[model samples]
Target: MAIDRQTVNRVAFLARLKIDDDKIEATEEEFNKILNWVEQLNEVNTDEVEPLSAVNDLPLICREDNVTEGSQADKILANAPMAEYGYFVVPKVVE
Candidate 1:
Protein backbone atom coordinates (compact mmCIF):
# COMPACT_ATOMS: atom_id res chain seq x y z
CA MET A 1 0.00 0.00 0.00
CA ALA A 2 1.28 3.44 -1.01
CA ILE A 3 1.02 5.99 1.86
CA ASP A 4 0.74 9.66 0.87
CA ARG A 5 2.08 12.72 2.74
CA GLN A 6 -1.46 13.70 3.87
CA THR A 7 -2.03 10.20 5.36
CA VAL A 8 1.35 10.31 7.13
CA ASN A 9 0.59 13.80 8.46
CA ARG A 10 -2.85 12.65 9.70
CA VAL A 11 -1.30 9.58 11.45
CA ALA A 12 1.38 11.75 13.12
CA PHE A 13 -1.26 14.23 14.29
CA LEU A 14 -3.51 11.46 15.68
CA ALA A 15 -0.55 9.82 17.49
CA ARG A 16 0.51 13.22 18.98
CA LEU A 17 3.85 12.91 17.08
CA LYS A 18 5.75 16.00 16.05
CA ILE A 19 6.87 15.42 12.42
CA ASP A 20 9.10 17.90 10.64
CA ASP A 21 8.28 18.77 7.01
CA ASP A 22 11.69 17.33 5.99
CA LYS A 23 11.00 14.00 7.85
CA ILE A 24 7.54 13.50 6.30
CA GLU A 25 9.06 11.68 3.26
CA ALA A 26 11.15 9.43 5.54
CA THR A 27 8.05 8.60 7.64
CA GLU A 28 6.10 7.76 4.46
CA GLU A 29 8.93 5.45 3.31
CA GLU A 30 8.89 3.64 6.67
CA PHE A 31 5.10 3.15 6.41
CA ASN A 32 5.49 1.76 2.87
CA LYS A 33 8.23 -0.64 4.04
CA ILE A 34 5.98 -1.93 6.86
CA LEU A 35 3.08 -2.43 4.43
CA ASN A 36 5.37 -4.29 2.00
CA TRP A 37 6.49 -6.62 4.82
CA VAL A 38 2.81 -7.35 5.64
CA GLU A 39 2.17 -8.06 1.94
CA GLN A 40 5.15 -10.48 1.92
CA LEU A 41 3.69 -12.26 5.00
CA ASN A 42 0.35 -12.65 3.13
CA GLU A 43 2.19 -14.67 0.41
CA VAL A 44 3.27 -17.37 2.94
CA ASN A 45 1.32 -20.69 3.08
CA THR A 46 0.02 -21.46 6.66
CA ASP A 47 -3.05 -23.59 5.81
CA GLU A 48 -1.65 -26.78 7.47
CA VAL A 49 0.36 -25.06 10.26
CA GLU A 50 -1.27 -24.97 13.71
CA PRO A 51 -1.55 -21.56 15.46
CA LEU A 52 0.63 -21.38 18.62
CA SER A 53 0.90 -18.86 21.47
CA ALA A 54 4.49 -19.89 22.33
CA VAL A 55 7.30 -21.34 20.17
CA ASN A 56 8.91 -23.37 23.02
CA ASP A 57 6.95 -26.45 24.20
CA LEU A 58 7.25 -25.70 27.92
CA PRO A 59 4.48 -26.61 30.40
CA LEU A 60 3.02 -23.78 32.52
CA ILE A 61 4.05 -24.40 36.17
CA CYS A 62 1.64 -23.14 38.84
CA ARG A 63 1.82 -23.33 42.67
CA GLU A 64 -1.13 -23.91 45.04
CA ASP A 65 -2.60 -20.61 46.35
CA ASN A 66 -2.16 -20.50 50.17
CA VAL A 67 -2.78 -17.90 52.91
CA THR A 68 0.82 -16.59 53.18
CA GLU A 69 -0.17 -13.23 54.60
CA GLY A 70 -1.45 -13.44 58.19
CA SER A 71 -4.20 -11.02 59.39
CA GLN A 72 -2.15 -9.12 62.01
CA ALA A 73 -3.43 -5.51 62.01
CA ASP A 74 -0.88 -4.04 64.47
CA LYS A 75 2.13 -5.78 62.79
CA ILE A 76 1.02 -4.62 59.30
CA LEU A 77 0.40 -0.99 60.43
CA ALA A 78 3.58 -0.80 62.59
CA ASN A 79 5.55 1.30 60.06
CA ALA A 80 2.60 3.48 59.00
CA PRO A 81 2.93 7.23 59.72
CA MET A 82 -0.81 7.69 60.28
CA ALA A 83 -3.15 4.77 60.93
CA GLU A 84 -6.46 4.60 62.83
CA TYR A 85 -9.41 2.20 63.15
CA GLY A 86 -7.61 -0.58 61.16
CA TYR A 87 -6.91 1.75 58.20
CA PHE A 88 -4.11 3.92 56.86
CA VAL A 89 -4.91 7.69 57.09
CA VAL A 90 -3.85 10.17 54.42
CA PRO A 91 -4.00 13.97 54.12
CA LYS A 92 -7.28 15.32 52.68
CA VAL A 93 -6.74 16.77 49.18
CA VAL A 94 -10.31 17.79 48.26
CA GLU A 95 -12.13 20.79 49.72
Candidate 2:
Protein backbone atom coordinates (compact mmCIF):
# COMPACT_ATOMS: atom_id res chain seq x y z
CA MET A 1 0.00 0.00 0.00
CA ALA A 2 1.21 3.51 -0.82
CA ILE A 3 1.42 5.94 2.12
CA ASP A 4 0.94 9.65 1.33
CA ARG A 5 1.89 12.83 3.25
CA GLN A 6 -1.78 13.44 4.16
CA THR A 7 -2.09 9.91 5.63
CA VAL A 8 1.15 10.39 7.57
CA ASN A 9 -0.03 13.75 8.89
CA ARG A 10 -3.41 12.28 9.92
CA VAL A 11 -1.71 9.37 11.75
CA ALA A 12 0.70 11.80 13.45
CA PHE A 13 -2.21 13.95 14.59
CA LEU A 14 -4.08 10.91 15.98
CA ALA A 15 -0.94 9.63 17.78
CA ARG A 16 -0.17 13.16 19.13
CA LEU A 17 3.29 13.15 17.50
CA LYS A 18 5.10 16.35 16.55
CA ILE A 19 6.55 15.50 13.10
CA ASP A 20 8.48 18.37 11.49
CA ASP A 21 7.72 19.31 7.87
CA ASP A 22 11.22 18.14 6.77
CA LYS A 23 10.63 14.63 8.23
CA ILE A 24 7.14 13.99 6.73
CA GLU A 25 8.55 12.38 3.56
CA ALA A 26 10.86 10.10 5.55
CA THR A 27 8.00 9.09 7.85
CA GLU A 28 5.75 8.35 4.87
CA GLU A 29 8.47 6.18 3.29
CA GLU A 30 8.89 4.23 6.53
CA PHE A 31 5.12 3.66 6.79
CA ASN A 32 4.99 2.41 3.17
CA LYS A 33 7.90 0.01 3.83
CA ILE A 34 6.08 -1.50 6.86
CA LEU A 35 2.83 -1.84 4.87
CA ASN A 36 4.70 -3.49 1.98
CA TRP A 37 6.27 -6.02 4.37
CA VAL A 38 2.80 -6.83 5.78
CA GLU A 39 1.43 -7.20 2.21
CA GLN A 40 4.24 -9.68 1.43
CA LEU A 41 3.09 -11.83 4.39
CA ASN A 42 -0.37 -12.23 2.76
CA GLU A 43 1.23 -14.16 -0.15
CA VAL A 44 2.32 -17.04 2.13
CA ASN A 45 0.20 -20.30 2.17
CA THR A 46 -0.88 -21.54 5.66
CA ASP A 47 -3.90 -23.75 4.81
CA GLU A 48 -2.29 -26.94 6.12
CA VAL A 49 -0.69 -25.38 9.22
CA GLU A 50 -2.39 -25.82 12.61
CA PRO A 51 -2.61 -22.87 15.03
CA LEU A 52 -0.53 -23.40 18.23
CA SER A 53 -0.44 -21.50 21.55
CA ALA A 54 3.05 -22.79 22.43
CA VAL A 55 5.84 -24.76 20.67
CA ASN A 56 5.88 -27.47 23.35
CA ASP A 57 2.83 -29.81 23.62
CA LEU A 58 3.48 -31.08 27.14
CA PRO A 59 0.50 -31.15 29.57
CA LEU A 60 0.68 -28.83 32.61
CA ILE A 61 1.17 -30.59 35.98
CA CYS A 62 -1.06 -29.55 38.89
CA ARG A 63 -1.33 -30.37 42.63
CA GLU A 64 -4.47 -31.12 44.74
CA ASP A 65 -5.91 -28.17 46.74
CA ASN A 66 -6.40 -28.68 50.54
CA VAL A 67 -7.70 -26.43 53.32
CA THR A 68 -6.00 -26.26 56.76
CA GLU A 69 -5.85 -23.76 59.65
CA GLY A 70 -2.46 -22.03 59.86
CA SER A 71 -0.84 -22.54 63.31
CA GLN A 72 2.23 -20.26 63.12
CA ALA A 73 0.78 -17.08 64.61
CA ASP A 74 3.49 -16.83 67.39
CA LYS A 75 6.28 -17.35 64.84
CA ILE A 76 4.80 -14.77 62.46
CA LEU A 77 4.20 -12.23 65.29
CA ALA A 78 7.84 -12.49 66.38
CA ASN A 79 8.91 -10.02 63.65
CA ALA A 80 6.30 -7.39 64.61
CA PRO A 81 7.65 -4.27 66.39
CA MET A 82 4.51 -3.94 68.58
CA ALA A 83 2.03 -6.89 68.89
CA GLU A 84 -0.65 -7.34 71.64
CA TYR A 85 -3.12 -10.22 72.19
CA GLY A 86 -1.81 -12.03 69.06
CA TYR A 87 -2.30 -8.93 66.81
CA PHE A 88 -0.27 -6.02 65.44
CA VAL A 89 -0.78 -2.55 67.03
CA VAL A 90 -0.51 0.57 64.87
CA PRO A 91 -1.33 4.26 65.39
CA LYS A 92 -5.11 4.92 65.20
CA VAL A 93 -6.01 6.99 62.12
CA VAL A 94 -9.80 7.51 62.57
CA GLU A 95 -11.19 10.25 64.84
State each model's C-alpha RMSD to the native: 8.3, 11.7
Q: Model 1: which ten-residue window has the lowest total lDDT? A: 62-71
lDDT of each: 0.93, 0.91
TM-score of each: 0.46, 0.47
Show where candidate 2 strays beyond 4 Å: 46-95
- Candidate 1 has an lDDT of 0.93
Q: For model 2, what is the alpha-carbon lDDT of residue 89? A: 84
Q: Residue 79 of model 2: what lDDT?
A: 90
Candidate 1, position 76, lDDT: 92
| Model 2 Cα lDDT, one tens digit per residue, 20-56 | 9999999999999999989987798979888778888
Q: Which candidate has the top score in TM-score?
A: 2
**How far off is model 2, as Cα RMSD?**
11.7
